[model samples]
Target: NAGVTQTPKFRVLKTGQSMTLLCAQDMNHEYMYWYRQDPGMGLRLIHYSVGEGTTAKGEVPDGYNVSRLKKQNFLLGLESAAPSQTSVYFCASSYVIGAGRNTGELFFGEGSRLTVL
Candidate 1:
């Protein structure tokens, strides 16, 4: 089974264009996260979901939105793409420990690279 899958591995968008990045996981993980990586700076969390139909803002959630409609799927959306938003997006999932804490390691997708002009 595919552990995690991200769609549109690569994408280019104009300044105001919008796009959605899809992430799917075969593993029944209760915690899923979206992160963006840029040069110099390390990965930054964008948005995350603790379970199906439950989502929360992460460290850097501005200009983006996330949804977890199904247990195995999480989607990230960019309403208006910007050059500042250009980065490699990674999707990860991990099992939740007791009290909803995540102690296990995360499984990450290959990553989706986005470039906005």
Candidate 2:
């Protein structure tokens, strides 16, 4: 089973354009997250969902919005694309965090490359 999948592996958007990146998982995980990786930088959290119908903002939530309507899908949207948003976006999922579980590990998709000009 695919852990997580993100559509449009590559995208190029001009300034002011808008787009949504779709993430889906078959594992039925209750925790899902959206992150962006820039060159020589660690993953920065954008948005996360602890469960269906519940969403939260993370470290860097500007210019982005998220929704988790179904248990298996998390959508990230950019209202207006900006050159500063050009980075590799990654979709990740994990089980609930506990002291002894593998909650510290994140299952990441190949990543969606976005170029804003």
Candidate 3:
């Protein structure tokens, strides 16, 4: 089973176009997250879902939306793609811990590259 996979390995978007990047996982994880990594910037959380049918805004959620309609899929939507939104996006997942130490074990998928101009 594929741990995690993202569609459209690369994409170019016009200033105001829209698109949805799909992320799928087979691990049955309880937590899923979307992050954007840019030059000189560490990974910043965009949106996250603790489980199916639940969603939450993250650090940089102004220009993004997310949905977890299915247990195996998490979708990130850009209503109006902008140059500021042009960054490498990564989808990650992990198991839920009641309370534990920091293992720092985050599973990341091959990122999706997007260019908005």
Candidate 4:
């Protein structure tokens, strides 16, 4: 049971609503990422953090905010939800396996499905 876990697996919100998705990992991984999966668009990175207390924007970060205040927790927040934001959100974590390089094998949570009306 020592892997990534996401809270509120399913949620529905109206336009302009706000919510936060919590991701916790007991594996002590150094890198954590938030991604959204949409029909035919595949998985797009929203935000990521390389270590505790640090975060950075990813490919699709316009409407999302992320925080990595603790080593084991990463939070993704939507300040204003929109219908276009409806998608399956995934959290992943991994650690570097070799010298300055990641193994590219991420442990993903069961995902959070969000629907905006």
- My TM-score estimates for the predictions, one after another, are 0.95, 0.94, 0.93, 0.96
lDDT of each: 0.95, 0.94, 0.92, 0.95
For model 1, how does the per-residue alpha-carbon lDDT over 1-117 read when each residue is reduced to its tens digit? 989999999999999999999999999999899999998999899999989999999999999999999989999999999999999999999997777465759899999999999
Superior candidate under lDDT, 1 versus 3: 1
Clashing pairs in 2: none
Winning model by TM-score: 4
Error of 2 at 39 (Å): 0.6
Residue pairs in candidate 4 whose N, alpha carbon or C atoms collide under 3 angstroms: none
Model 1 stretches with alpha carbons more than 4 Å out: none
Q: Pairing residues by index, what is the TM-score of model 3?
A: 0.93
The lowest-lDDT stretch of 10 consecutive residues in candidate 3 is 96-105
After superposition of all CA atoms, the RMSD between model 4 and the true structure is 0.8
Q: Residue 5: error of model 1 in Å?
A: 0.6
Give the per-residue lDDT digits (tens) of candidate 4, residues 1-117.
659999989999999999999999999899999999999999999999999999999999998999999999999999999999999999999998878677889899999999999
Deviation of model 1 at 100, angstroms: 5.5
How far residue 47's Cα lies from its native spot in candidate 1, in Å, is 0.5
C-alpha RMSD for every candidate: 1.1, 1.8, 1.6, 0.8
